[model samples]
Target: MTSAYAAVYKEWRDDPELFWRKAAKAIDWIKAPQKIFDAGAGVYGLWFPDAVCNACANAVDRHVEAGRGDQAAIIYDSPVTGTKRTLTYAQLQEEVGTLAAVLRKHGVEKGDRVIIYMAMIPEAVIGMLACARIGAIHSVVFGGFAAQELAKRIDDCAPKLVLAASCGVEPNRVVHYKPLLDEAIELAARKPAAVLMLRRPQEPATPTQGRDFDWTAEVEAARAQGLFADCVPVAATDPLYILYTSGTTGAPKGVVRDTGGYLVALEWTMSNVYDVKPGEVFWAASDVGWVVGHSYIVYGPLIHGATTIIYEGKPVGTPDPGAFWRVIEEHGVASLFTAPTALRAIKKEDPAGTWLQRYDVSRLRALFLAGERADPDTIQWAEKILNVPVVDHWWQTETGWAIAANPLGLGMAPVKYGSPTFPMPGYDLSVVDDLGHDAGRNEMGTILLRLPLPPGNLVALWNQEARMRAGYLDDFPGFYKTGDGGYVDDDGYVFVMGRIDDVINVAGHRLSTGGMEEVIASHPDVAECAVIGMNDAIKGEQPCGFIVLKAGTSGTHERIEKELVQLVRDKVGPVAAFKTAIVVDRLPKTRSGKILRGAMKKIADHDPWTTPATIDDPAVLDDIADALKAKGI
Candidate 1:
């Protein structure tokens, strides 16, 4: 079986270009483009040679054609309500196909944008796939985003149809999405044609300005009306989805991903990095707004015919630590993928208590962690608690593909904590020096990919020609600059320090704020830590740490601060010492659980909080800032 799996991988890897060409032959092609090799002009690559295709075909239709229609397509779980739904590949096809007809009947056609405001629900999945199936481009704003945030996306996309949920229960609270959309529509100059609403918890919410159409009624009407929507075969390079990333500077750019290139990259990465197995359960815990959700949650796993889990609600919902375990138990999830933030909390909550004891995780063979760097402590915590080897991989949205992965089915056991371990096949990782030269052994430099083009990375951001050019091409010139600082160790494992700006320069000595957080988290008194640099009269910049202590760990400023400072020094050398360590009850975090270091840094520097668009607890920043100020800056 091992050799057979490898043989399959090798046969495809050896001629992936050929394999993709063949695999795509199954998709219905429209007018084919005439240029597959226009990439020499820098950041402008034409793909699919003018062939027309639907994203849903590769994700669903083809899987059915391969006789895997009985296989599970999606296993959806609601952690807050403890409800579950499973759709088979055939069932998915019918649902998406039916919905595509309804969308077409409603005047959502090719080139039209559809705004999806929803959480992780079957309707949301069906809506996105249905749009892809019928050639309407989708833009999914995160469900946690407020009306102001959703209005920006809606105005930008200018969608013809808005697919939204009435309301949904999150970990701790009920979100009223219909009211938000209604508010946004009321604020809009040109409202969308209609808002198709899902009845979450079957609660009948107030209608949206006479434009609200009940989804259940509409879907049923479409089936009853016997309307079969015609498929509009889009050019392979046609836009599939427009994802917005909060720019480091300026307004959010609509990052457009088209049919062929995007899906090809996603399918390639899923099969290669994760070793996707047909009929096996694959769970990617990301909000649909994120690129991870777009690719893995909707595209990659579905295309592979793997059963993907769409989990709604937070990891720790209400007052239970076993929310995740219950989902795994309910679904019998085989492959689990999540972030280290959730892992850290789970480990902290149940140090020696086996939460996995609650589930039949026998089906769970491989566990992967990404999104951000999972520190050595998180890795060890997972190992001690979960009893499953937590494989850490690294990538970015710009790269499109996972550059570094601990590839499945390969048995090499050099576990370098906090490292991606090795360069994945078909990619090369180099730490280039400031002088545009490669670094020496164990020396840090700007991470650059030796690139003509990798399979998974985008050629450029859509529509913004110069924006794409400046973001990727102009920076490193010939190399894809990753904007990260890392070094390949003597053992050839790549150790990522953090983002270049995330490094603290204290008296001209480069120190990673991430490194300090790792050491601080290891202390028994600490639950989490966020580190940043602040200006000082003398040292130019000083390390300032904001940390949340473990429950009941005496919150006195003098005692906790001294203990943490000494703990870091003892654990990771005096080089890791902070100028001041602050103890707080909470840290500002995104709804996705990423600590808002950007917001914290803004507060520390007296700058505006530009990126805290959907903060879970915005008031946490105030408490943290107050605590930090009490320590005399």
Candidate 2:
């Protein structure tokens, strides 16, 4: 018997237009799409071409009108600042309306750009919804981003207004946002006309005399005057937002999401992929800056009438490893979505699930992992502890939702150790060789999606059509190159090994660094590991494993290293050329919990490298350099 997931996928594959047309009915469209797709319209055609809709109305106003006014729309939990707050649908509608009025007062009109630079705060969500309400395109840059990086985004999007907070709270210190914003404005050629700064008690900022306005003052004045902005309908093909993802050329690639397509896609995922229902709490432990946060934390849950969570804390810090559990228990979170890096950090600190036992997370139905490859070791550990379906999905910032995921609402699929299940509806996944031909089963190659990418995927790069084509489409003509290297198994399970560049050539023999890391991470003493190809004059590049041991692990580092080397040799065979293994206290990661493998490789190769602006801690890079030096690499 075919699984429900497989049957639904076939239904979609049969007629994508009919499938998307059915999905579009879920949204409250001002003008429903008559044409599902227009092949000649955009970079890869367009979805819902004749539709007109307001994202904010569907997300906030409709819920209140549907008698869900008292339902909690958002739960703000900030352990770092000792703050917890909740907003009902009615309350959120009022807040978003007032903010939209304030934006209108400042001459921000439909199609005008607004940049939101805020910490994990309720107001950040309000800012985004406010922009959507007024048909203004909002671009969110991560708070505390370097002035230069922030300036690059400002120039790229050329926003008319900026929304920001006073400061961001970390476990140890406060990162002031005003200074960075000020410096960024000074650096940008195209400056925003105005800035609205939210004053936080932690570190209030002195605004620039001419350009800055107090967020509370503006919103309160608008509210007192009974000014509430109404939703403005925009064409479905209009750009909703521009989210910047890092590009190889050191320039930010702004990914544009269409209004109607985004609303439809996210709404479907909330029900099908995550199996979340309205009124139940769903938590995506990520910052508003990242794509996951944009899709799940802010847009998806709200549109679906589910109570979303904005958690401002780390997996291990800001109290302890039990922070996630506390939120789940307190909020009755039905599902949790986060990066695999977070679970590994928690496992490193509390390998025995000691912290987890303190809280009752019986309400959690499933745990969704993304952002990075979810190794088998980490998934198994989470499954053994949570006693819930730990689903590993694959997606990118370019694709707003999951590319490959096991549809929980349809029915559960059998768990595959390393695969991220099958491709979700609308994504026609193909594993192709370097020359664009289909690779055989289980053969490592580049992954591509067939032409005319589904709704919710990026419409185009902001003002850089040539770059988008050259970077993604040109490489594999007729397909959208995923840039990832992986293969489909006999059962049609897509296994994303790593980036195509991650496949290193050793003595003219290709080796997957992800394959080697899997073996090393399976060690009993290891909590997490990263394998990078080190420059070797003899073999061109040799695999070097860096392992982080679990808390209270016994035995010497040298002994563990020897065992890891032997483990990889046994699993990946002698052809892997994996001789070196180094045990480290911790691996360097970005603020979003992605291991900085590229930076690590550059360091190991003794090449010129600079600290990544997104790094969680600069000191961690120094530790890695010291470790490499100690090993005489």
In terms of lDDT, model 2 sits at 0.92
lDDT of residue 41 for candidate 1? 42
TM-score of 1: 0.91
Q: Which candidate is the best by TM-score?
A: 2
> Once all C-alphas are superposed, what RMSD does model 2 give against the true structure?
1.1
Candidate 2 has a TM-score of 0.99
- Tens-digit lDDT track for model 1 on 573-612? 6764475887777777776677777777777877666546
Give, for candidate 1, the lowest lDDT window spanning 10 residues: 1-10
Summarize candidate 2's per-residue lDDT along 258-299 as a digit string, tens digits. 999999999999999999999999999999999998999999
Error of 1 at 141 (Å): 0.5
TM-scores for candidates 1 onward, in order: 0.91, 0.99
Worst 10 residues of 2 by lDDT: 244-253
